[model samples]
Target: MFKKPTTVNRMSQPEDFKNAFVVGTANVQSDGKLKWKIVAIFPNAGSLRQHGNILVVAGPGGGKGRIITVNLISWGHSAIVIDLKGETYTKTANARYKVDNGKGKVVVLDSKNGTGHRYNPLSVVSRDQWFDLAAELISVTNGDPFWSSVANDLWLAAWSAAQHARRPHMPYAVELMKLDLSDAICYFMYYHKDDPATMQHLLDFLGTRPNEEQMAKIKGGNASRLLESMWKTVKTTMTIFNDTILLNLMSGHDVDVEGMFYNGGITTIYVIVDETKPRVFAAFGRLIMKTLGDALIREGDKQNVVRRPILMLFDEFGRVRLNDVFDWLDTLRSRDIVLCIFLQKLSQFAPKNGKEFDESDENSFHHWILFAPNNPSGRIGKLISGMSGQTTVRADGGVGRSVNMDGDITTSRNVSFARRAVVEQEDYETWGADQAYVTLRQLRTEKYVVTSANTDNLGWALPPEAQPLPRLSSYVSPLMPLPSEIDAATWTAAQQIVEEAGGDDAVSNAMRAALGGLGMAVTV
Candidate 1:
C-alpha cells in the first residue's frame, strides 16, 4: 500500500562486526539523526545481534538474495552455505570473509569436482551420534510404508553394530550396506550376550536360532525374504555412499562442526552437488543439515554456551527436507545456531513429504524476507499473506446528483466506500520483477525495493584465493591405513600377521576377507 523508504542513511561499523562491513544505508532526518529499517545484521546498536536467525524467500535473479549473503559474510559470521550454483559464496563471500580481521576461514567442499575438504558424514560425528544419524537417513522415505519400516530397522541394526565395533575411524558405507542380516544378528548375539534383553530383541526380530542355525535359516526361511526386502529399501539410500567421490569425502573426519564454530572461527562448508546426480546430492544435503544441526546442539550443551553464532545459509534449501528441521529451529538458538533458509517457494520445504509446516516452525524464525511471489495467488504468497494478515482499502468513490424543483435546484450526494486487502491478492499474481516484502519479529511485515551492496566494499571476485582443505586426497590409497583401522590392542595380532607379509595387497585382502567372515562383506 505504501512505497518503500527511499531516503538513504549511512551507518558506522559496529565493534563486534568486521571493519567496513556495511549492510545497507538507512535514512537520516533533517535534525541530523539517522533512522534505520532493519538493514545490517548486527547494526551499530547491540540488540539486533541477539536475534540472528532469518529466513529469505527469493526467486532467481532477485538481487535481494545476494545482498543477504554478502552482509552475513561481511559481518564475518561463521557459516555453512549450500550453494547450488557455486557462484555467490565461493567467489564473493568467501573472499570477503577471509580478508576480515576476525578469526574466520573459508573452506569449499566441491562434491562434483572433488576439489575441497573431505567431510565424511558418517565419520564427522562421535559414536553417540550414530543412532541419530541413522534416523536422519531413514527419514527421507519414498512414500512406501512397509518397506520403509523394514529399512529403518535394518539401518538401526547396522548402525548400532558400527558404533559397537569402535574402529579407528567410522565404518564405510559399503561396510554398513553389505552387512548380511544373519551376520548382524550373530554379532549382536555374541557382543550383547551379557545384555540378555538386547539379545532377546534381536532374536525376536530376526526370528532365527542364536548360533550356527541362524545363518542357515536367514538364507532359506521367511527371514530370507524379510532381509531381501530390507536391502531393497536401503539400496537406494546407499547411492550417495556407493559413489567413489562421495565416499572419499564422507570417509574421513576432515570437517569438524564443533571445532569450526567453537572459538569464533568462521568455517565455510560448501557442499557442491553434481547436477547429474540429483538423488545422490539430495541425500548428502539432507545428511549434512541434520548432522550439523545435531552436532551444534550437543556442542552447545557441552560448553553451556556457543562461542560464536553459526549460520547455515542454504540456497535452494528446499532441495532436502531436514528430518528434524522443526525441532532444530525451535531449540538451536540456545546454542547460538542461526538458520537462514533460502528457497524459491515455501511448498518446497514439505514437497511430497506429506508434512505441513506448523505454527512452531513459523514462530521459530526471527525474520522473513519474502520476495515478490512468481504468482499472486501462488501457495507461497497465500501462506505468507495469511501470516502477515489482510489489509482493508477503499474500493469505490462517492457520487453526486442534482435535482430541480418548483423554484430552486436541490443537490444531493451519495458516497460509497469499499474495502479490500491492503496487499491485494493480485499484487502477488503480477509481482514486480524487483520488489520484495520483509517481515521482522516486531514489525511483522513491510515492503522493500531490493538493493545490492557496494561492490567496492566487498572483497575479491570469482575463484577466491584460498587454500585447499587439509585432508588425505584418497582413502582408497594403498599407502594409507585401511579405512577399518581400529585400536592398537585389537590389531596387535593382525598387525603382526600383516607385518610378516611381504606386500600390503595380500594383507589388505586378508583383512577385508576377515570382515566378510564376520558378515560385513566390505569391498575395499
Candidate 2:
C-alpha cells in the first residue's frame, strides 16, 4: 500500500524552492500539482536568504550539461563556476551577461594559460590572516611533525614579511620563502621593528628566545640536512604557483570578492582549468573559499535578505579541492553561500589520500540528485533503493481449477501483498535517457520520475571581455642593522659594550633599540 502524503509529497514543497535548480518537473500527478524529485533546500521565511549545499551525481549522457551548466543561466545569483575546459563559459557566458537585469559582471580567471582576468588572491589579505594563508599554502602531509612544524614557521615568517612589506603576492612569498634564514630574520625584524608581537614571532621562528639564549640550542640555519629536506618539500608544494603564468596571474588584484556579492548586481566568475595542472586549482579554490566564506558568514549574520546568494557551481568538482571543504560546508549553513558539486559518481568524491570515507561526507549536501545510473545495482542504486519506502503489491494465485456449481469453472486463489522497493535495483540501471532520481535529506523523500531535462532558458552568449594584466609591483623596508649591515668596527664596539654589561644578549637587539631611536631598521 502507498502512503500518499508521506511518500509522495505535495508539489507545493518544490514551489517553495522556486529559485533552486529544477531536478525534474513531472511526477505522478495528484491534487492539481505535479509530484517530482527536485534537489532543493527550503529555509524558513526568516532564513529566506540561505540555501543548503548540493550534490549531483550523473553519469555519461545523463544530461550533466543541461542540468548543471545549461541551467546555470537561471541561477540569478553570484556564482563562481569551475569550468574544466573553456566550454562552460563559452556556452553560458552570453546568458550570464544578461542576468541581473543585464548588469551582471562576468569575469574569467584562467591562470594556467593566462587568459581572461587575473586574480591576486592575497590582494585583500589582512595582517592577522597571514598565518592562516601561510598554513593553507603549505599543507600538512604524512611526514615528520618536526619538519612540518619548521616549514609552517618558515611560511609564517616569509608571509608576514611579504604582507607587511606590501607585496602580498604568491611570487613574492615564493621569493621570500627561498631566502636564507638570516636574510629572512633581518627582513622580518626590520619591517616589524615597531611591532613587538611580530618581532617575537620572528625570534621564535628563528628557534631562539633572547632571555634564555644558549649557544648549543641554536638550530636556525638552512645548512642543516633536516632543514634542507623541509625546504625541498615546501618548494615542491609551492611549485603549484612558482611558474611565470601562474605567478603573473596571482601577482595582483583585479577581482573584488566582497563587492561582487554586495555590488547590487549579480557577478558570475568562471575559473578555467587545464586538466594537467589541477593542483593549481587548489590554490584558487582555497583563496575563494576563505575570502567568500568570510564575507558571506559576516553578511549572513546581519540577516541582509536583500543580498543575493553566492552559488559556487563546481562541475567535475571531485577533481579539485576547496580549502577545509567540510568545515566550509558547516559554516555555510544559513549563510547565502551555496555550492553545487557535480561528479560522474559518488565514488569519485571519496578521498584520494587513503582516508576512509564516512557517511557524514555524503550528509554534507542537503540534496542529492541521481540521473540514469550506469549501474543501478551499485552503491548509488542500493542507496536509492534503501532510501525509498517499500510498497505492498496484491497478487492472486490458485493451486488448481475446479468446476463448482452449474458447470462453471472457478478456482479459489491465495492472495498475498508482498513488500517491494519503490525503485528496484535493476530498474534504474536500465533507465532511459529521460529518467532521473532525486532525494532531499530534510524531507527524507525520494522520487523516480521522467525528468523534463529542461534547458530552454539557455541562450546566446557574448564574447568574454579581455582584461589587461595588472602592473608589476614590489615593496621593501630598509635593511636592518644586522651584523652583516653594520661596519666591522661598530659591530666589534657594540659586542664589547654588550660583554661589559655582564650579560650575553646578542648585540643585534641593542643595535635595533639604538636604531629604533634613530628611526633605522634592526634585526633580531
Candidate 3:
C-alpha cells in the first residue's frame, strides 16, 4: 500500500477553520449557519418585542390554554382572558401564584348568566365612551328607525338620570338629548331597514313634522309597515330606565369599585351569560366590548400618556356581534389597547344576508392564527389558506410502451411507463423494478402552526398531557424582588463609601484606593 503523506499533529482541523470564517466585516460565523449564529437564540426567553401583536388559533383539545398560561409565566406580562366553556385553568403547574401575584388581588369576571355577572355600560366607561359604544350597538341593528328611536330615548333618559345624580360627565347626557332626530333617524334607517328612501323620509319627517296627509303617504309606502313595527319596538324598549343602583350592579361593584378605573390596577369585569341561550349573551358581550374600547380611547386622549395596555381577550368571539371590532382593531393599537379574539372558524364571521365580505378594511387585524381545521375545504380552510400564503402544484403524464432487441435476432418487448410516477423512476428502480409501482399522489391533511406574534408562544407540541410544563412564573415576581435590585445594591455601596469620606480630600483618595483593591468603586 502507498504510504500516506507524513501528517503533522495540529491543535485544530479544517472544519474548525470553516466554522470561524467571516462572511463580511464584523460578521463572524461561530456556528454552521451565519444567520442562525447572529440570531439571538435564548432557549427560554418568553417576551416578544413590542412592534406587533400575536394570535393563537387551535382546535378543541389542541392545548391553546396551556400554551397561553406558560407564555404568561415566562414573559412577566398581564392578560385578560374571557374564559368560556367553563374550563378552569387551575390544573397547570403553579397556577395559584400566577393568579394571585401576592397583592391580595386576583380578579376573575365570571360572565356566565345566573352567576350574577352583568355589565352595565354606564359604570365602566365615561359618558363619551358610553355614547360611542351605544352608537356601535345601534349601528349593528342597521339603524332600524325603531331601534334608533329607542336608543335615542334611552340615552336621553340615562343622561337625565346621571345629571340628577350629580355625575361629573353630565354634558354627555345633554348632548344626547341635543342630537337631532333627523340624524338619529338617518343612522338607524340606513343600517336596520336598508333603505335610503326610508332614511330620507325619516329625515324629512324630523325636519318638518309631517302632516296627516304626508304621514298617510309614508304609511302607504313599501317600507311603511316595517318602519311602523320598528318604531313600536324601539319605543317599548327605550322606556326602560337606569338608576344609580342599576349602574352599580352592572359594574360588579359598589360606588368604591368605580373609582378603581381612575386608580391603576388590572380590573377584570365579566359580563357572563349562558352560551346555550345565545340571544342575551350575544347582546351583552357586544355591549361590553364596545364599551371597553370606547373607554380606553377616551382615557388615552385625556391622560396624554399611554401608561397602560388594556388587553381584551374574547374567547368564543364567533358568538358576539363583530361589526365595530374591525374598526377598533385598526385604531386600538395606537391607543395602547389590544384586542385578542379567539374564534373557532372563519365561517362564523361571514355576513348573514348575502353581503360582500370586506377583508381590506383598515380596522381588520394584521395577524391571525390557524389551528387544525375540522373541514379542510370549507370557508374556514379558504380563509386560512388566504392568510397563510399557500400555493398549489400539479403534474401530468401517461403510461407508454418500450421495446428492446437482444442477440442476433431482433425481439419486440413491452415495458410499462407512468404518466406521473408516484416515485421518481430512479428511486423506483433502486427498490427493484419487479416490485409494483405507484404514481400520482397528492397530500392533503390539516395541521396547526403559530400565525401571529401576540400568540406565537401558545398551543401544544402534542396533546395537553404530553406537553412539558411552562417554567416562566418561577423566575420573578412583580410584588416581590425588583429586577434591578443587584444594580441598586452596587450603587448603594458606592454611595456609602462617599459618605464615609466626610469631605476630607486625603481620606477620600485613600477610600478610593481601598475600594479599588476590593474590586469596587467610589465616585466623588
- For each candidate in turn, the TM-score is 0.61, 0.65, 0.47
Clashing pairs in model 2?
A: 94-461
Q: Which stretches of candidate 1 lie over 4 Å from their true place?
A: 1-22, 25-52, 93-103, 123-128, 139-150, 160-171, 179-233, 303-306, 351-361, 373-375, 380-465, 468-472, 475-524
lDDT of 1 by residue, 37-77 (tens): 22334322223335545666555654344455445544445
Provide the clashing-pair count of each candidate structure.
5, 1, 17
For candidate 3, the per-residue lDDT at 28 reads 17
Top candidate when judged by lDDT against the true structure = 2
**Which of the two, 1 or 2, has more lDDT?**
2
How many residue-pair clashes does candidate 2 contain? 1
Give lDDT tens digits, candidate 2, residues 373-491: 33445665454443323211111001011111111111112211111112222332232102223322211231112234443433345544522423333323222333435334443
Question: Which candidate ranks first by TM-score, i.e. highest?
Answer: 2
Candidate 1, TM-score vs. the true structure?
Answer: 0.61
What lDDT is obtained when candidate 2 is compared to the true structure?
Answer: 0.50
- The whole-model C-alpha lDDT of candidate 3 against the native structure comes to 0.36
Q: What lDDT score is found at residue 492 in candidate 1?
A: 45
